[model samples]
Target: MKKSSKDSVVTAAILLFNSKGYSGTSIRDIADAAKVNTATIAYYFGNKEGLLEYCFTYFFEQYINKMEASFATIEKGAAICLKRVVADLLHYQWENIQLASFVYREMSIDSQMVREIMATYSLKEKYYLQKIFERGFEWNEFRPHSIPYLIIQLKGLLMMPFMNTHYMREVLYVFPNEKFFEQKYLKDLYQWIDKTLCSDIQIKKEAIIK
Candidate 1:
C-alpha cells in the first residue's frame, strides 16, 4: 500500500522530533524530509504545533488501541492480562522507537498537549491498568498493592529505555532499537511484573489473611 502524504509528513516529523527536540525541529525540516513542500504541510497540519498535535494524537490513538486490544483478547487472570499489556507495550515501543522516544520526551515537559493527553489518553491507559489490577486483587491472582505507585513504576520501566536512548547508547552501551535489547529488556520487565506485581508468596499471604 502506498503511504499517504500526511503519513509521510508525520513520519518525517517523528524522526526529526526524535533526533532534535520538538523546540529545535521546524516545519521546513519535516517538509524536506517528507519530500513535500511547506505549503502542503501547512495545508495538512496548519502549523508546526498542529503537526505536533497530530503526531501526539496519532501516537496515543494507536497506543490506546493496542492496549485495548491486548486487554480485550485476554481471558485469563489479571496477572496474565497485565503481562500481555506490558508485553504488547514493550514490543510496540520497539517497533515505533522513534515515535515512542519523541512522545515520552515531550511528556516530560508541561504544555497544553501534555495536559490534554493526561486528561484523555493517559487517564484511559491508567483506567485499563487499574482495572486489571483490581481484577487480580479480586481473583487473588496478585497481591494488594498501591495502583498509583505500581503504575508509576510500570511507566518508569517502560519509558526509561526509550526516554534515555542517548544514555542507553553512550553510557550504558545498549542500543534500545536493537532486537537484542528488546529481548533482554522484555525479560527483565517480565521478571519485574512477576516479582513485584504478581508474587506468589504475596498473593498467598493475602489469601491466608482473608
Candidate 2:
C-alpha cells in the first residue's frame, strides 16, 4: 500500500531528527522529503509540534504493538511473558534508535513534551508492565517488588545502549548499527535481563516469597 501523507511526513521528521536535532528540522524540509506541501503537513497536523506529537504517537504505537504481539501466544506464562517483553524492548531500542533519540531529546528539556508523553503513551506502557508484574506475583510464579521501580530498571538497561550510542562508541567500541540480534549481542542482554528480573523457576504459593 502507498504510504499516507501523514506517515510520510512523520517518517521524514524522524529522518531529519536523526540527522539534525529537532530544532534544526524545518517544515519545508519535511515537506520536500515527504513530497507534500508544507501547507499540506500543517493542514494535516496543524504545526511542527503537532507533527511531532503524531510522530511520538506513531512510534510508540508501533513499539507497543510489537511488544503485545511478542507475548500474544503466551497469555499465562509470566517468565515467558517477561522474556518476550524484554526481547521486544531490546529489539525495538536497537532497531529504532533514531526514533528513540527523537523522544529522548525532547524529554531532556521540554517539560510539556515529557508530560505529554507520560500522560499519553508512557502511562499506558507503564500500566501494561505493572499489570504483568502484579499478575506474575499473584500467581505465586514470581516475586513482585515495586512494579514502577522494576520497570524503570528493566527499561533503563534496555534503553541505555541506544540512548548512549555515542558514549558507548567511545568506551566499549560497541557498534550500534551492527547486527543487533546476534546471540551474544542484544539477545544475550535480553536473557540476562530476564534472569536478573525473574526467578530461576516458577515456584508454588508457599515456596515463593514476594
Candidate 3:
C-alpha cells in the first residue's frame, strides 16, 4: 500500500530528529524530506513539538497495547508472561530502532512532553509491570524484591542497549540492530529473570536456617 502523506512526514521527522536533535532539526528540513509543505505539517501536527509528542505517543500506545495483549493471553507464571511482554516490547523497539533510540534520548530532557508521558503512559507501564510482579510473588514464582526497583531494572535493560546504540556499536562492538544481537539480548534478559526473579529465596532462607 502507498504510505500516507502524514506517515511520510513522521518518517522524515524521525530520521531528522534522530540525526539532529529535536532542537537542531527544523520544520523546513522535515518538510523537504517528506515532500510536504510546512502548512501540511502544521495542519496535521500543529508544530514540531506536536510532531515530537505524536512520535512519543505513537511509540507508547503501541508499547502498552502490546503489553496488555501479552498479559491477557498468557496464563502461565510470571516468568513466562514477563518473557512474552519483554519479547514483544523488544520486537517493537527493534522494528523502530531509530524512533526508539531517538525517543529515549529525547526523554532525558525535562520538558512538558516528558512530564506528560511520565504522568500517563509511564504510569500505565508501571501498573502493568506491577501486576506482573504481584502475580509472581503471589504464585511464589519470583523471589522477594521491591517492585519499583524491579521496574527500574527492567526499564534500564530495555532502554540502555537501544538508547546507547552508538556505544553498543563503537565502544562495545555489539551491533544492536542485528538479528544475532536480538537473540543474545533476549537470552540475557531471560537469564536475569531466572536468576533474579525466579530464584527461590524462601528455600534459600530455610536452608540457611538449617
User: Which number leads on TM-score?
Assistant: 3
lDDT of 2 by residue, 15-103 (tens): 89778777898999999999999998988999998888777777788878877776674575766677777777766766777787677
Instruction: Identify the runs in model 1 with alpha carbons over 4 angstroms from their true place.
Output: 201-210
Model 1: weakest 10-residue lDDT segment is: 198-207
Identify the candidate with maximal lDDT. Answer: 3
lDDT of 1 at 179: 94
User: Which scores higher on lDDT, 2 or 3?
Assistant: 3
Once model 1 is optimally superposed onto the true structure by TM-score, how far is the C-alpha of residue 130 displaced, in angstroms? Answer: 0.6
- Provide the global lDDT of candidate 3 against the true structure: 0.89
The clash number for model 3 is: 0
lDDT of each: 0.87, 0.73, 0.89
Candidate 3: tens digits of C-alpha lDDT, residues 113-175: 899998999999999899999988987878889999999999999999889898998999998
Off by over 4 Å in 3: 201-210
Write down the TM-score for model 2: 0.78
Q: In candidate 2, where is summed lDDT lowest over 10 consecutive residues?
A: 200-209
